[model samples]
Target chain A: MSAIYKRELNAYFTSPIAYVVYAVASFFAGLLFVATVLEGDTSDMTYLFRNMTTIIIMMIPILTMKLFSEEKNKKTEQGLLTAPVNLLQIVMGKISAAVTVYALLMVLFIIYALIISFFVTPSWVLIGSNILGLLLFGTTLIAIDTFISSLTESQVIAAILSIGAGLLLTSISMFKNMVDIDFVNDIIDSIEMMGRYENFTLGMVKFSDVIFFLSISVLFIFFTIKVLERRRWN
Target chain B: MIEVKNLVKKYGDKVAVNNVSFTVNEGEILGFLGPNGAGKSTTMNIITGYLSSTSGTVTIDGCEILDDPKGAKSKIGYLPEIPPLYQDMTVKRYLEFVYDLKRVTLPRKEHLAEVCKVTKITDVYGRVIKNLSKGYRQRVGFAQALIGNPPVIILDEPTVGLDPKQIIEMRNLIRGLGKKHTVILSSHVLSEIQAVCDRIVVINNGQLVADESTEEITTNFTGMKRIQLHIDGNDNTVLMTLRDVDGVTRVRKVMRTIDGFTEYIVESKAENDVRKAIFRAMAKVDCPIVMMRNAEVSLEDAFLRITAGETQVNRKGGR
Candidate 1:
């Protein structure tokens, strides 16, 4: 697992996707920080975290697009598949590599928050809670994108489809409000990724919400492993 | 040692490998000979545990692939048809990754050095694999397969797209490896297998057609004894005389000269020595037998005959 993780992490750096996504994502984060919080007198880190949740809808796909698709497309999966390592090890290696990069992106947000400290005193609890929520949220997004990447051999298709899935998951909160049916609204509110995250933004870190995000991540990773095994048999 | 028994692989409705069984003893080089889409790769894939077989089992060094994949896979090194390289990585890094993936217990640096030396890729070890030429990339692939010094190595068409010089080098490398490891390689090129393998297993249309030693297959195929004759006579007269000769099953004129001499190839009914009979018949017809020699069946002809569904005839003389 470590071997695959190291190789995958190196590949992310060698390929241009890592740098491109970092530049584009950091640029958007800086733009949003300056336009919304810096230009105004108040400093609500929730706005920054909310925008980040949206930013990852576009950025997480770029990070996880080539995870399995590139290996399958290039036929490099033969080497990995024939080795002594099992399928779950390979999947975890790839997921952790993406998470490592996502963690780095979140660290960069620290710099944005530190810069905000220069103008006004921001609530440290809000910043910490929101960052925790974003990390869990980004991990779930990466896991979902990783599964999507496993479904196809073309990285472009993987990226496009993952972005579409991320959009749907984030948009579930909007659907919950737009619907008039009580049962439908309750179901959507329970399943919506951002709906669960709203508690964290309100400075309440609930154990159930953390478990919800983690469960979704594992479910998707499990699905990806099943896809790989099915491919071998068929 | 590696043993595959009654292996069957199906890709949906297509049976890629049907009840294929073969074994490679220790320190032996087994050649898999077949045409394109002949189930050679599919069989190799199943044996290496890359693809699951519909039925049957592959055991390497007494460990079943499906039951104990880690044990079986650790004993074998595989090079697929395309080399399965990480093109973006430097050759050295790619090999290091393979070493870790294989979980080699040997000293890492020395094992890598030995592999590089054997494959003759030490010079380009630091270069990116994508930037190397095809031959160099192939050599790099070979280098990784040697890492950890696995006891069994499976190579699929190792010399498919190489130049003649590189092909010879690669063959020599594989031959050298045979002294220490069991090797199974697949190729459609008849001469390549003839020069490398201790035993040959021929598969055609998803079935094992022939499995014997290199010499056995060649000699069995040569059972249809043929003689090339240079007779001093008219083309049609020499052909008819040879055709009528006792033990001569068929005769065809190969070339005719303006000075009333002709060349003909005469085939016998079975594995008979038809040289003396042809000489005596030529003397009787007053047509001097200028030259006569047995036509040997090359491995190319043998492969064609076996793949063309003539297994029974070839099997008669081969054990």
Candidate 2:
């Protein structure tokens, strides 16, 4: 797992995608921060968190586009699979590597908060909560992207599907109108990733929301491994 | 070192490998020969634990791959048909990643050094694999399989896309690996199999129909032996006269324009030697038999007969 993690993290920086992801996400997040904090007379950072989610969606695809898709395409999957490690170790290693990059981006965002603390005033509690939310939210996105990347051999297809899946999951709150159907509305709100994110950004630690995000991430990671395992037989 | 039993891999309704079973002893080189999509890749994939079998069991070095995958997989090293490689990584870096993933003992710098020496790619190790020639990339791939010092190595078409010189080099490298590990080299190339393997496993239409020593498969699969006869006579009458010989299964004209005479090719039953009879028969026909030679079965003929019969006969473990 450590080996795979190092390899993936190195790949992120070796290519231009890592810098591009950070530049694009941090740019818009900074703008949203100024508008929500100054013009709107609010430091709630709900808007900041919302923008961070969007950044993650677009950037995570670029981050994970090469994970398994490129391996399969380049025929490097044989090298990895034939190696002595188990499937779980390999999958976890790749995820950890992507998460490391995501963590680096989060650290950059935290630095932005530190700058805000010096210039105006930083809500450390809210900032702390947001970081936690970012980790949870980032992992969820990475899990989805990783799974999508594993499903195809084409990087373009994997990237597009990951972006689309991220959008779909984040937009689950749109189905709240189905409150007319009590059960359906309950399920959507429970699975609603953005709805769950609101609590983390607001500095309220909700156990159910935390568990839901992690659960979703774990579920997809397991699915990705299963998809990979099935490939051996066919 | 490897055992496969009743292995059947199906993609939906289409079977890729059907009821394939074979064994490889320690330090033996087993060759898998088949046509394209002949399940050569699928079988290798299953044996290496890359893909789960639809219905089968694979045991490597006494450990079942499915029951204890990590244990079984650790003993096996597979080079897939395409030499799956990460192009962006340097050859050495890629091998390093393979070593890491293979979980070799750390701090054993000597093991790593020895593998590079064996593959003879130390000079090219520092360069990105994307920039290396296909031959070098293949050697680097072989180097990856050699990591962890696994006891079993399975190489699928290891020399598929190489120049003639590189192909020979790759064969020598594989043969060297065979001395230390149980190696399975899968290819449709007949000479590669005949040259490198101790035993041959021939599969056709996803079935293991022939698994025997190379010579045994050659002798049994090609049911008839071939002979070349140079007859001092006109083409038509010599052909007619040889066709009537008792032990001949087939008679064909190998050449008629060599020196203004016909050269007949006679295929006799596998167990029968009709050379002396044809010699005397030609003498009596007043058509002098200048020279007669029997042609042993080649790997090409063995592969064709085995694969062709695998589709047609559906034989049940006929020894």
Candidate 3:
């Protein structure tokens, strides 16, 4: 597992995906922060993470796009598949690596907070709650990207499809108001990623919201592992 | 050391490995022979627990691959056809990573040193794999397969793209490994297997066509006893005389004007060797035989028969 982790982490940076992901997300994040909160008079850290959730949705695919897809495309997955390690170890190692990169991106949000503190007092409870929300949101996005990566061998397709799917899930809340059916509205709102995240970003930090995000993340990761497991027989 | 039973792999209606079964004894060097897409690599993959067999089982040292993959895989070291390298990594880093993946129990540094010493990659360890030649890349692949000193080594076309010198070196390395490890080397190149393997298993269309000791299989598959004749008489007379010999099945008089003597390639009937009768007959015809030899059946001839002359397509292209 450690071997896979180290190799995958190094590959992310070596192949330039990690740097590209960090630069693209952080640059747009920087711009969003400056335009919305940094340049504005009032500062809401939760407001900043809420806005950056879009950036996370867009950029998570780059971090996880090649997790399994590129390996299979390049035929190097044979090396990992034939290794002494089991499939769970391989999937978990890659997921952990993607989470690590995602965590690094969230750390950039801290820099945004520090700059905000220069103008206004930084609220500890507000910042703590926002960071927790950011972690849950980032983890779920990474898990979605991981599942997308397992679905295709072409990394580009994986990235595009994941971004498209994530956009749908993120805007599921908006679609609920647009649709007239009551049952559909309730189902859509319950499954809406941002709907569950709205409470956390609003500093409520409900246990149910945390559990929803955690469960979705595990469900997607479990699905990705199953996709990989199916290859042995196929 | 390894047992594969009724193994079958089907791709829709096309069977890749169809009910193939074989066993390798401990410390035996087995060779897998087959033409392109004949399921040699697929069999190797199933044995190494890389791919699951559709409807059968493989037990490596008593641990079934499906039941205990880690235990079974720990016993077998595999090198696929393409070497499965991370082109970005240097040889040392790549091998160290493999060492970790194999979970070598010895101290990490010591185990690495042992692998380097055995594979002779210590000097070139710092070179990036992409920068290295194909031969070096192959060696790096072999080094990884040898990392944990597994009892069984499964190499698929190990010497595929190597030069003559590297080919000899790899063969010698595998031969040396046969002293301690049960090695299964698969190749379409019969000479490669003939040089290294103790036993040979010929597979075609996913079926085990033949399995025997290397010499036994080659000799059995050759089917003809060849007699070379250096006759001083006319080629036509020698040809007719060979036909008159009771056991001679067929004769091809080789066209060689070497020092004004003739050579004949007289193939005997499957179970007959009429060398003594031919010698006596040649003496009677006053065509004194200068030299004679029974052409031993080569591994190449055996492989040609195994692939059913499909390899003759190469000759057609050459022509």
Candidate 4:
């Protein structure tokens, strides 16, 4: 598992995709910081975190689209699957690699917050909680995209499907108004990732919201392993 | 070293390998001979645990592959028909990854050096696999298989895309590996099987058709032996004289005129030596026999006959 992690991390650096993702996400975050913080003349990071969440939704798919799809296209998955390692380890290794990159992007937010401190006092507690929320949200996205990558051999298809799934999960709360039933509305609000993310950005770390993200990531990782294992028989 | 029992693999309703069972002993080179889509690769994939059998079990070194995969897989090294390689990675890093994936407990430095030396990929260690030539990439794949020093090695068409020189080198490497590791190689090339294999197992249409040694498969399939003779006479007289001889089953004129004489081929029934009978018969007819030699059956003929379902009748009739 560690070997896979190291290889994946090295692959990210060797190719231009990782740098491009970092540059694009950071560029968008900086632009959002200027428009949200400077224009409003407020120290609150609520708008910044909300906009960054949308940016990361696009970034995570690019980071994960080629994770398993390239392996299958190159026939390298045969070596990986037939190795002595189990399915869970391989999946975890890949997720951790993507998470590590996501974490690196999250660290850049600290610089943005520090710059905001120059003009007005920024709430370190609120900044810390929002960072935690973004990390958890990115984890779920990465796990889901990893599963999506396994479902096909073409990276383009994986990326498009991941973006579609991410969009649906994030905007699912809007569709709740269209439904008149209370039960359906309640289900959508609970499963809506953006709704769950709103608590952390408001400087309140809800236990239920944290559990939701953790469970969703775990379920998807489990599904990814099942998909890979079922391939051997099919 | 390896045992496969009733291994059947089906992709949906299409059966790929049907009731295929074979065993390889320690320190033996078993060649798998079959044409394309003959389930050679499918069987290799199943034995190596890359694919699951529909209704079968593979036992390697006393451990079942499905039940104890890690234990069984750790004892074998496999090289598929297409070498599974990460083209972007350098040869050194690629091998390092394989060592970790295989979980070798030995000292890494010495083991890698030895594997590279054996596969002759030491020169390309620093180059990326994508930039290397096809032969180098193949050697790198071979080196990856030899990383953990597994006791059993499976190579599927190791020399498929290599030139003649590279093919010979790969054969020598495999031959050297056979001294210590039980080797299972699959190829449709007849001469490769006859040259490198200790025993040959021929598969046709997902079924085992013939299993015997290299020499035995050739001689066992010789239902009727032919003797080619050059006679200094007309074609009809020589053909009629040889046809009247006892034990001569059929006679045909060969499409060649050697030294101003017509060549007639005489086939004998039941593997009998009819040269002396034909000699006396031709002497009586005053048709002088210029030259005579026996035409032996080769492995190529045996492969064609066995795969074509013609060997059954020949097997029942001949000893």
Candidate 5:
């Protein structure tokens, strides 16, 4: 598992994808920071963290689209699957590598808060909670996108499908409002990812929300392993 | 050692491999001979635990592939049809990654260097795989399979895209590997298998057609031996003399050369060597034989005959 993890991490840096992801992420995060912190003259990072979720939704597919799809395309998955490693190890190694990259991006946000600290003292607890929330959210997105990547051999299709899934998960609240039935609204409210994330933006670390994100990540990672296993029989 | 029993793999309603079974003893080079789309790769994949057999059992070094995949896979190193290489990595990093992936206990630098020397890719060790030529890339793939020094090495069409020189080099490399590791190599080229394998398992349309020693398949599968002769004599006397020779089934004039030599093709029973008798008869009749050579029955002929339902006869007659 460590072997695969190290190789995957090196692959990200060797290619141009990691830099492109960072550049795109920094562009959006910088834009939001300038608008929310400088023009509004506020030390509060709630608005910036909240808006970064949308940027993450758009940028994470780029980091994960080639996770499994490129392996299948180049026929390298045969090597990985035939190696002396279990399916869980392969999945975990890949997801951890992508998460590490996403975590590095989150560190960029910490730097933004540090820059704001010079003017007015910012709450470290709030920043820590927001970073933790973003990390969990980004990991869940990576797991989901990696599963989508495993289902297809083309990276473009994987990226498109992942972006579609991310947008749908973020917009579940809108669907809940559009429906009038109480039972259907309750179901949507329970599954809405963006709503659970709002508590973290306000510096609240809800345990249930944490469990929800972790469960979703585990479910998708399990599905990805199943898809890979089923492919061998096919 | 590897044992495959009643292996059957089906993709939907189409059967890719049907009740195929064979074994490779230690230190033997077993060649899987088949044409395209003949499930050669599928069988290799199943043996290496990359793909599952719908109904079968593959045991490698006492470990069943399905029941104990890690144990089975740990003893086998596989090189698929296309060399699975990470294009973004340099050769050194890629090999180090494979070493770690295989969990080899040997000293990393020495093992990798030895593999590179054997595959003759040490000079290109610093370059990225994407920039290497097809031959160099294939050698790197071969190097990857040798990292752990597994007991069994399975290669599917390892020399598919190489040039003539590289093919010979690859054949020599495989022969060297067979000294220590039991090797299973698959190829459609008859000469490649004939040159490298200790035994050949001919597969046609996903069925095991013939499994015999290299000499047995070449000698017994032909059924009839043909000898081409060029003689400088009267055509009538040459034909009459050759006809009286024992075990000579048929004799006919093929062509007349510009130098007054007549060419004749003589067919005989497979077990007989009628060359001496023909020479004596020709000498007695004063028909000087200019040249004589046996016309070998190629692998294509034997393959076609076996695939055309002569397997039962060949199998019974061969051993």
Candidate 6:
């Protein structure tokens, strides 16, 4: 698992995707910080973190687009599958690699928060919770995006489909208002990803919300392994 | 040692491999000879644990591939038809990654250096795989297979796209590897297998047609003796005289030479030495014999005969 993780992490840095993702993510975070905190005359980062959800949702697919798709295209999956390693190890290695890249992006946000601290005092607890929320949210999306990447051999298609899936998961709660049935609305509200994240943005680290994200991530990782295993039989 | 017993692999409705079975004893080089789409790669894939057989088992050293994949896979090294290479990685880094991926316990630096030296890719070790030529990329693929020093090495058409010089080099490398490892090399080229392998298993249309030692296949299929004759006489008289020989089964004119001699191939029964009879018969007809020699039956002819459904030459288990 560590071997695959190290190779995958090195692959991200060796290619231009890592730098491109970092640049685009930092540009958006800086743009949001300047527009929301500087001009709005507010030290509260809740609005900034809240608005960054869309950016995280859109940017994660780029980070994970080539995880398995590139392997399939280049036929390197044969080597990995034939090696003396289990399917779970391969899936975890890729997930860990993408999560490391996502963690680096989050670190840039903490740097932005530190810059905000020079002038006025900001609540570190709020910043901590927001960062934690984004991390969990981003990781769950990463798992889903990685699973999507494993489904196809084309990296462009994987990225596009992953973005579509991420947007649908985050915005599915909006359909609750359109439906008249109370049970349907409650079901949509229960499963929506963004709704569970709202608690963390308000400085509440709910255990149930954390478990939701963790379990979703695990479920998607499991799906990715199953997809790979099924491909062998094909 | 590797034993593939009654291996059968099906891709949906199309049966790619049909009850194919063979084995490679320790320290032996077994050649898998087949035409295109003959289930060579599919069989190799199943044996390597990359694909599951529909209803079969591959036992490597003592572990079945499906039952103990880790144990089975650790004992074998496989090079597929196309070398699985990461284009963005340098050869050195790729080799290192394969080493780590295989969890080799050997001293890293020395083992990699030895593999590079053996495959003669030490010069391109630091270059990115994308920039290297096809031959170099192939050698890099070979280098990765040698990383763990596994006992069983399976190469699927290892010399597919190489030049003649590189093909010779690859064959020599495979021959050298056969000394320490049990090797199974697959190829469509008849002479390549005839020159390199100790035993040959011929597969055609997903069926094992012939399995025997390299020399035995030719001799077994050489049951009908063929003799070539060059006669400097009239074609009809030479043909009739050669046909009149007691042991001559058939006679056909091959070609007319520029030196006023006609070439003909005369086939005889298996136990007949019809050369003397043909000489005496031709002399009686006043047809001067220019040249006469026994036509050597090559592996190419044997392969053509076997794949054409003319012979069944399985020597395994005396069946």
lDDT of 2 by residue, B1-319 (tens): 7888989988999998899888888999999988887999889988988888889799998899888888998898777777777778887777877777777885546777788899889888789988988888788878878888889998989998999999998889888888899999999987889888988888888987777787666556477789987889877778787888889877878676567667777888888988888877787788998777777777676577667772243333213
Fnat of each prediction, in sequence: 0.76, 0.86, 0.75, 0.61, 0.80, 0.69
Give the per-residue lDDT digits (tens) of candidate 2, residues A1-234. 899999998888887878999898888887887888656766566777867888888889998888999988877887787666777888999999999888888876577677666757878888888888989998998998999899899999999998998898889788678568888888886777887787888887789888988999999899989988877755
Tens digits of per-residue lDDT for model 3, A1-234: 999998888877777888988999889888877778866766776666788778888888888888889888877788888888987888888988988877887778678778878888777677777778888988988888888899899999999998998899888777666868898988997788886677777778899989998999989879988998888878
Tens-place lDDT per residue, model 4, B178-217, is 8999999999987887778888888888988777777777
Candidate 2 overall lDDT versus native? 0.83
Give one digit per residue, the lDDT tens place, for model 6 in B1-319: 8999888888889999999888889999999999889999999999999999998789999989999999999998989888889999999999999999999999999999999999999999899999999999999998888889999999999999999999999999999999999999999988899788999998888888888888887567677788988998888888878878898877879798888789998887789899888888888889889898888766677687788786456556212
Reference-based TM-score of each model: 0.89, 0.86, 0.86, 0.88, 0.88, 0.89
Candidate 2's docking class is: medium
The window of 10 residues in a row where model 5 chain B has the poorest summed lDDT is B310-319
User: Whole-model Cα lDDT per candidate?
Assistant: 0.87, 0.83, 0.84, 0.87, 0.91, 0.90
Please write out the lDDT profile of model 1 over residues A94-210, one tens digit for every residue.
999999988888877688778878987778888888888988999999999999999999999999999999999888776666768999988887778877887888888999999
For candidate 1, give the lDDT: 0.87
Candidate 3 error regions (>4 Å): A177-183, B221-245, B248-298, B309-319
lDDT (10s digit) by residue, model 5, range B1-319:
7999989999999999999988889999998998889889999999999999999899999999989999999999889998899998999999999999989999989989999999999999999999999999999999998889999999999998999999999999999999999999999888899999989997878888888888888776567898999998898989999999999987979899888899998889888999999999999999999999998766776766666664473442112
Q: Is the docking of candidate 1 incorrect, acceptable, medium or high quality?
A: medium
Write the residue-wise lDDT of candidate 6 on A110-210 in tens digits. Answer: 78778778987778888899999999999999999999999999999999999999989988987878979999988887779987798899999999999
lDDT of 3 at A111: 85
Q: What CA RMSD would candidate 1 show? A: 4.8
Model 1 agreement with the true structure over B195-229: per-residue lDDT tens digits: 99998999999988888888887666666777787
Span of ten consecutive residues with least summed lDDT in model 3 chain B? B310-319
How many steric clashes between backbone atoms does each model show?
Answer: 0, 8, 0, 0, 0, 0
